[model samples]
Target: MTEVSKITLIGHSGWGPVEEAYEERLTVSAAEVTYRYHPIKATAENVAHRWRYWTDGPALVNAFENLAAVVSTW
Candidate 1:
């Protein structure tokens, strides 16, 4: 499996410390590409679509493409 270089926690202002604690537990920093994205509160079935709608879906795809390129090189 490809290594995870980024982690975006999905929540809102309500989940402030929850997000912080989650990041701390993971130990991945913003400088390292880990981030607190917290765009929307997704319904269980529509999480993916809602995320794509709320966040920049194209940018996410581009990031994945870049990661794929690096992994392929490896």
Candidate 2:
């Protein structure tokens, strides 16, 4: 049996509309798409902190693992 490909998308809460539009265009793909939303403010400090948290958090780590698994099959 063949394994379905998967994709992960990480973005700020404010980009919901854009993300939705992008997702809509992906409807014909066989790949599974998963989204991870993070709250971020306009200030530089807030933006930096949120990005740091996202990159170091457990959820992102798992996402990387999932990505690695998919790449291994190619």
Candidate 3:
């Protein structure tokens, strides 16, 4: 048998007043999760790459959840 552990990381950046606080709450709610601000030069290329790895690419054995937002739509 293999041991498995699931971790959900909610990356939050460029959030408004409301959502910004919401992210904080999520961080507190999670028992063991990582949270951080994306780098200034995190462009689309890096975003896709990170997402793929975070979700375990080419395996379909792991799962991930993304909570991204656009200021224009908020």
Candidate 4:
């Protein structure tokens, strides 16, 4: 059996506030974390096409790099 050591949860939404706090609000610590920064105005039509908002920019690259670095330690 493979025991899970660490995990990360990525979330997305259609819209949100102007700025969001990415800090964890839990009092306990564990091997899991979450991230939810994207908040685009999307609809069914948008979903039909590729997710260009985040895919075709440095944000994705930076996010990927950060994710990789975090996972590397787990």
**Which candidate has the highest lDDT of all?**
1
Over 1-74, each residue of candidate 3 has an lDDT whose tens digit, in order, gives: 32233434464455544323322112211123344444444444433222122332433332222222121123
lDDT of 2 by residue, 1-74 (tens): 45434343433333444323221111111223333323232343222221112234566556656765675577
Taken over the whole model, the C-alpha lDDT of each candidate is 0.40, 0.37, 0.32, 0.38
Once fitted onto the true fold, the runs of candidate 1 whose alpha carbons sit more than 4 angstroms away are 1-56
State which candidate, 1 or 2, has the greater lDDT. Answer: 1
Ranking by lDDT: 1, 4, 2, 3
Task: Give the higher-lDDT candidate: 1 or 3.
Answer: 1
lDDT value for candidate 2? 0.37
Residue 12 in candidate 4 has what lDDT?
A: 42
Model 3 TM-score (2 dp) = 0.19
The CA lDDT at 41 in model 2 is 29
Q: What is model 4's C-alpha RMSD?
A: 11.9
Native-to-model Cα distance after best TM-score fit, residue 68 in candidate 2, in Å: 0.5
TM-score of each: 0.26, 0.28, 0.19, 0.28
Give, for candidate 4, the lowest lDDT window spanning 10 residues: 20-29
lDDT score of model 4?
A: 0.38
What is model 1's C-alpha RMSD?
A: 11.2
